[model samples]
Target: MLPRSWVAGARRPGPTPPAARRSRLYAHLFLWVMQSWLAMFYIGAGYAKLTQKHDLLALMMTWPAQVDTELLRVIGGIETALALFIVAPLMSWSLFRSVMLVGAAGLLADAGGMVVFHTLNGDIFLAAVNCVLLLMSLIILLGRWEWRDHAQLRNATS
Candidate 1:
C-alpha cells in the first residue's frame, strides 16, 4: 500500500512526507488484517494436527498414505511455529516484524512443497489451495523486506 516514493526505495534526510506517512499507515493496517487471518487459520489447523487424533486422519487424508502420524505432528509443529511468527507482530512490533519475515519465507517453502506433493498425488484442487497460500506467503515475505529496508534507510538518513 506504499506510495510510489516509498515503494521505489526512496530515501531522504527528513521527516516522512505526509502522503508517505499515510501510505505507511495503510500498509500496516492491511498487513495486520491479512496476518490475523493467516495466524488464526494456522492456529486451528496446527492444533488439530497436533492433538486431534480422531479428525487428523480425515483431515490429512489428502496427504500421501506414507506420511505417518508422527510426521503429521512434525508438520503441525512447523505450522505452529510459523503461525507464531506471523502473530508476533501483535506482541513486540520490532521482534515480530523481523521474525515474521523469516517465518513467511519458511511458509512459502512449505506451501511450494505441498503444491508439488498434491499435484503428484493427483489432486489439482489441493495443489491450487497450496498455490494460493504460496502467493500469500510470498506477499508477506516481500512486503516485510521492503518495509524493513525502507524503515532502516529512513532511520539512517534521519
Candidate 2:
C-alpha cells in the first residue's frame, strides 16, 4: 500500500506552470461532463414530475407523512433550477455554490426517503442506487467548490 505521507503530500498545492493551465482546463472539462450528467438526471426527473405519471405519483405517495405532494413538486422545481444553474455560464460562482449546496441537501433528503421507501418495500437495488447518487452529488458539489476556491486563491497569490 502507498505510504500515508504520499497521500497527504498529494493534497498539497504544487506550482502550476504554463502547461498546468492546460491540465486545469482538462480538469474543468471533466467537471463539466459530470455536471452535464447530473443536469440530465435532474431534467429527466423534472419531466417525470411534471407529467405526473401514475408511477411517479404513486412513488410520491410513498413519501414520508411529513412531506406533502406540494412539497415534492417544489423540490422537483428546485432541482430543475439547480441543474440549470450548474450548467449556465451566466450564473455567478456564488450563485452556483448556493444552488449546489441546496441541491445536495435536497438530494440527501430524497435519498433518505428512497431508503425508507425501499426498506419498507424490500427493494434494495433502488435504495442502493439512490444512496450512491446522493453521495456522488455531494462529492461533486464539494469538489467544485474546492476547485473554485483554489482557483481564486491562486489568482490572489499570483
Candidate 3:
C-alpha cells in the first residue's frame, strides 16, 4: 500500500472508448450465447445417446442404428464431457484457457465426423446441422485463440 517506487512507474487507465467498450460487450455476449447453446445441444444429444434404447434412438436418427451401440455411447460420453468442460467455471485460470481451445477442437472433430457420417447415410438435414456445429466450433476456436501473445512469442523467439 505504501510502495512509492512501484506506484511511480504505474499509469492509471483512462475511461474506455465507447467503440472499444461496445466491442468488448459484444464479444462477451457472443461467448456467453454460443457457450449456452453448445452446452444445451451437446447435453441433450449426449443424454439421449447415453440413456435411450437403441430402437428408440434409431427412430429419431437413423445413424444410431448403423453405428455400434458401444461406439455411440462412447461418442455420447465424449460430447457430454466436452460440453461440461466448455462451460466449466474455469476461464479465470490461464491453464483453463487452453482447455477451452481443446474442447472447441474436440467439438469440431465430433461435428466433422457427424457431418461425414450423416452425408454418407443420406441424412441431409442432420449433415447440415453438423455443418453448422462445425462452423460454431471454428468460431469459438478463433475467438479464444490468443493471437497477440503467440505473435509476440514468435517474434521474441525469432
Candidate 4:
C-alpha cells in the first residue's frame, strides 16, 4: 500500500509537494507573460483603430479603407474589451477566474475572423499576425482551462 503521506495532494492539501509547487509557479509565470504580451498587442491595435481616421489608417493597412468606419470602431472596442477581460482574473478575486476563459474564447473568435478578413483582402502579413494571435489565444485558453474536477463540479453543484 502507498504511504499515508503520499496520497494525492488534491485530497490532502495541507501543503503542496515541492515539485508540484514549482510546476504551478512556472505555469503561472508562463500564463502571465503570454497574457501581458497579448493584452499589449490588442490594446495598441485597438487604440490605433479607435483614434485614427480611416484615411490615416488606410495608409497603414489597406482594409481600413474598405471597412466601414462604425464597424471598424466597433471591432476596435471589442478588441480592447477582450484584452481587458483576459487579464481581469489576475486583477480580480478567484471568483473571476472564468472571465479568462470567456476573454480567450472571444479573442480566438476575433482572431479567426481577422484571419479570414485579412486573407480575403490579400493582406498576407496581417493574416500571419492573425494566425499568431490565434495560436496564442489557443495556448492561453487551453492552459487556463479547469480540466481537473470539472466533471465533479457539475455533479457537485447540481
By lDDT, the best candidate is 4
| TM-scores vs. true structure, each candidate | 0.78, 0.60, 0.86, 0.86
Off by over 4 Å in 2: 1-15, 55-72, 89-97, 147-158
Among all windows of 10 consecutive residues in model 2, the one with the lowest summed lDDT is: 59-68
lDDT (Cα atoms) of all candidates against the true structure: 0.80, 0.68, 0.85, 0.90
Q: What local lDDT score does residue 10 receive in model 1, on the 0 to 100 scale? A: 57
Off by over 4 Å in 3: 1-16, 90-95
Worst 10 residues of 3 by lDDT: 88-97
TM-score of model 3 vs. true structure = 0.86
Q: Which candidate is the best by TM-score?
A: 4
Query: Regarding lDDT, does 3 or 4 come out ahead?
Result: 4
The TM-score measured for candidate 1 stands at 0.78
> Model 4 over residues 1-158: C-alpha lDDT tens digits?
99876876656448778999999999988988998999999999999999889899988888888989998899999999999888998777486678878989999999999999999889899999999999999999999997877878988799
**Cα RMSD, each candidate:** 7.7, 9.5, 4.4, 3.9
Candidate 2 lands at a TM-score of 0.60
Please give, for residues 1-158, the per-residue lDDT of candidate 2 as tens digits.
Answer: 99767675346566789898998798777766777777788777766655575455765655433456676677677667766765664367655666666665666566676677777777677678777767767766666666677897999899
Deviation in Å, model 1, residue 135 alpha carbon: 0.7
